[model samples]
Target: MAWLLLIVGGMFEVGFTTALRFVDNFRNLPWTLAFFGSVTISMGLLEYAARSIPMGTAYAVWGGIGAVGTVLVGMIFFDEPSTLIRVLLILTIVAAIAGLKLFA
Candidate 1:
């Protein structure tokens, strides 16, 4: 269940981060609301995940997942770079997240 929460938090993190550009420096009310809502949910779920998971492991996994997810979301939706280097970096983050899960 903690892993589930972590994934949920990651999803929310991706949402908020990707929405950041659309928010237009907080001038766009709808996007601003979405950004704030997603980030709030993400933090709440991260706090819940920390209750059962070790702090270092949970934090690393959460950050790694969010980072990778956000980049993928950006590439897919925002027409950001999808270079081979970026893919390799994302793969490394995935491996690190898996290693942390296994060792945790």
Candidate 2:
């Protein structure tokens, strides 16, 4: 359950970042609200999950999910470059996240 929350938190991390891009330095009210709400939920969930999961492992996984999700969002929605090397590297991060879970 903690792991599930951690994953959800990581997804919210992605949401917050995406919202950030639309905020126009905080001038956009709706997206600014989204950014803050997403951040609040993300942090709350991370804090809760950290109570059970090892801090280092939880943090690494959370960060990995955020990074990978954000990159994919950029690629799929924003037309960011998706070079072969970039994707291969992202897969390694996914593998590392899985490895942490497996060995934890």
Candidate 3:
């Protein structure tokens, strides 16, 4: 359950980060609201998960998910570059996240 919460939090981390690009430096009210809302939900879930998961492991997994998800979202929706090296690096992060889960 804690792991599930952590995963959800990580996904919210991705959402908030992606929403940031649409914020237009906080001028866009809707996107700004999305950003704050996601931040609140993400941090809340992360804190809940931290009650059971170790801080270091939870933080690393959360950051990894956000990094990988943001890069994918950028490439698919925002015309960000999707070079081979970039993909490989993202995969590496995924692997590391998996490893942490496995060893945890």
Candidate 4:
């Protein structure tokens, strides 16, 4: 359950981060609200996950998900760079997150 929450939090992290781009330095009210709401949810879930998971492991996984998800979202929706190297880096993050879960 905690792991589930952590993953959800990670997804929310992506939401907030992507919304950050739309917020345009926070001049857009709708985007700013989205960003803040997503971030708030993500933090709340992370706090729940911390009850059962080590902070370091949970944080690493959370960050990994956010990073990979944000990159994919940017590539797919925002026309951000998605070079092979960047894709590989995202893959690496996935593998590391999996490794941490397996070894933890």
Candidate 5:
């Protein structure tokens, strides 16, 4: 299923970003490799899913997934702020993603 691939790809987007934080400007060999590997799979799946999904919708959804996921990762693992407005905005992104999926 294209949707499955897209969701999984989005998760890989999270993986790549998390790994990126640990890369230390590419000096950390393991994290660097993990970043590249995850990104490769993420993009590959996005590329494939785009064959069926509309390009604009697919790209927007992909970015939304990445943005929301990265922000959550930051707050959870990096002790980033979890202010009310920030969380509300993140929920908006989620709503938008859901809207796109439902309307697509």
Candidate 6:
């Protein structure tokens, strides 16, 4: 279940990051709350998962998930760049995350 927790925690990392864009420098009340709430939940889960998983692997996977998820959300909702190279790089991150899981 540690892996499941890690994945969920990583998803929350994505949530908090994507929510950050809508925070408007902490002026938007709802988005600001979302950002903080997600941050807490994500960190809590990460810490919990780290109890069972190796610290380095858990952290790296969490970062990879957050990075790739944030980029995809930005491209879909915020009109961020979606060039072929960018997509390929995101895919590379996915491969790395998978590699970490496989080798762990």
- The candidate scoring highest on lDDT is 2
Report lDDT per candidate. Answer: 0.90, 0.97, 0.94, 0.94, 0.94, 0.93
The lDDT, on a scale of 0 to 1, for candidate 4 is: 0.94
Please count the clashing residue pairs in each candidate, in the order shown.
Answer: 0, 0, 0, 0, 0, 0
**Cα error of candidate 2 at position 46, Å:** 0.4
TM-scores, each model vs. reference: 0.94, 0.98, 0.96, 0.94, 0.96, 0.96
Q: Which structure is stronger by lDDT: 2 or 5?
A: 2
lDDT of 3 by residue, 1-104 (tens): 99999999999999999899899989999999999999999999999998898999999999999899999999999899999999999999999999999998
Cα shift from native, residue 10, model 1 (Å): 0.9
What ranges in model 3 sit over 4 Å off? none
TM-score of 4: 0.94
Stretches off by above 4 angstroms in model 6 are none
TM-score of model 3 (CA atoms): 0.96
Alpha-carbon deviation at 91 in model 5, angstroms: 0.4
lDDT of 4 by residue, 1-104 (tens): 99999999999999999999889889999999999999999999999998899999999999999999998998999899989898888899999999998998
Which model scores highest in TM-score? 2
Badly placed stretches (over 4 Å) of model 5 are none
Query: Which residues of candidate 1, in runs, are more than 4 Å off?
Result: none
Candidate 5 C-alpha lDDT tens digits along 1-104: 99889988998999999999999999999999999999999999999999999988888888889889999999998999999999999999999999999999
Model 6 clash count equals 0
Which pairs of residues collide in candidate 3? none
Candidates 1 and 3, the one with greater lDDT: 3
